[model samples]
Target chain A: ELKVEQNPLFLSMQEGKNYTIYCNYSTTSDRLYWYRQDPGKSLESLFVLLSNGAVKQEGRLMASLDTKARLSTLHITAAVHDLSATYFCAVVNNNDMRFGAGTRLTVKP
Target chain B: EAGVAQSPRYKIIEKRQSVAFWCNPISGHATLYWYQQILGQGPKLLIQFQNNGVVDDSQLPKDRFSAERLKGVDSTLKIQPAKLEDSAVYLCASSLDWGLTVGELFFGEGSRLTVL
Candidate 1:
């Protein structure tokens, strides 16, 4: 079984602050994905990290993967109120993908 | 392009009742997946289908939950004798098969079920 663990499941940060959410998996994976979801909404893809040392950034959000360590991170730079939502990191191995518990971020303005 | 489509945005029923949800994947997508997401948790894969054939259903609760994709296009999920723990969001996603590569999945708004 593949297990994914996320740290600091609930985070409340002030606007303009920086924070990082960590995702660690128990087994080796070929790809990792970051997704965001607002209350009552479906997931929105944030980034797809396919290789070790892979990093992708968009606006205030950035994601990176380290396959050797079986870890991934989602970093929020200068967070804004609109970025408040639940973030999830999913690890994919072969044909299966397992998701982390998720990090609920609340950006207070 | 339009994303995956799901119907009955919300459903409320008593325990032991039966309910069904529908989904329509993106045009030309050959793979579809159903997931269960409880409140405050990440989505858990229930079943997956590739062009009308089930590819994986190991996590599905076979005794009460069933799903099928017909003609490789639309899909439906049915749950009978629902339990309170089954109250959650049912999400539908679709992706293009690229043989061995993990493709990005497009998700629907999801159907929220509440069992009282």
Candidate 2:
């Protein structure tokens, strides 16, 4: 059984603050994905990290993968109210993808 | 090109009733997936299809659930004798290929099912 655990399941931060969400998996996998989902909406792909030390950034969000440690992180810099949502990290192995429980972020204005 | 498409944005039915959801993947996509997501949880893969063939249905409940991708295009998922626990969102996603290296999935808005 592949287990993916996320830290700080609930986060409350003010606008313009910086925070990081961590995802740790129990197995070895080379592919990791980050997604954002608003209340009542489906998931929106945020980043796909394909290799160890692979980092990708879009706007104020940055994601990095460390395959050796079986971990991934999504860093939010200078957050805004619009950035508030539930974030999830999924690790894939041979087409079997397991997702973390998720981190619910509340960005206050 | 349009994104993945799903029908019946929401549905409500009683226990023991049957319901079906539909999905149309992005054009030319060879891999399609169906996932069940309960509130506050990540999507769980129910079934996957590569063209007209089934790739993985290990997580699917065959006794009550059935899905098919005909003509290697649009697909449908059916649940007979639905149970209260079946109330959740059913999402449809599609990828260009099966290999993780070559594919990134695009998801539909999802069909929300409510069972009484």
Candidate 3:
């Protein structure tokens, strides 16, 4: 079974600051995914890290994976109020995908 | 191209009542998944289907929850005699390939269920 864990289940950051959310998996996984969910909305795909050292960025968000460490990071660069949302990281081992507890982010001005 | 579509955006019912949610995946997608997301938690996969066939249903509560995707394009999930613990958002997602594929899974807006 693949168990996914994320650090700092709740985050509160000021606008224009930066932070990173970490995701660690218990087993070896081939794929890592990042998603964002707004209040009362469905989840939206952010990034897909398929290999070690893979980094993807979109707007103020960047995600990277380290397969050897079984870790992935979603970094927020100079965050803004629009970036406030719950972030979830999921890992796929074999054919099963397991998600973390999610990190809820609140950006205050 | 239309994304995943779901119906009954919100439902409020008392304990022991029944509720059903529906989902229609994107065209040509072969994989469909149903997930339950409780407040302040991540989405939990309840069932996954690969073109009308059950691929994984280990986490589903068969005692009270049931789901079906007969034609491989749309699906329905039903909960009978619901409990307070069952109050959550039911999300539907679809992918173009199987679970092992490395791609984004399009998701629906989800149906929120409130059990009193």
User: lDDT tens string, model 1, A1-109?
Assistant: 8899998799999999999999999998978899999988999999989999999999999899989899898999999999999999988887788989999999998
Give the Cα error of residue B55 in candidate 2, in Å.
0.6
CAPRI classification of candidate 2? medium
TM-score for each of the candidates: 0.98, 0.98, 0.97
Report lDDT per candidate: 0.93, 0.93, 0.94
Model 3, stretches more than 4 Å misplaced? none
Candidate 3 global TM-score: 0.97
Arranged by DockQ, best first = 3, 2, 1
For model 1, how does the per-residue alpha-carbon lDDT over B15-88 read when each residue is reduced to its tens digit?
99999999999998899999999998899999999999998999999999999987899999999989999999
Question: Which 10 residues in a row give candidate 1 chain A its minimum summed lDDT?
Answer: A90-99
Cα lDDT for residue B13, candidate 3: 98
Candidate 1: stretches off by over 4 Å: B98-102
Best by lDDT: 3
lDDT, candidate 3, B1-116, per-residue tens: 99999989999999999999999999999999999999988899999999999999999999999999999889999999899999999999999988757567899999999999
DockQ of each candidate relative to the true complex: 0.73, 0.75, 0.80
- Candidate 3: which docking quality band? medium
Which structure among the candidates has the greatest DockQ?
Answer: 3
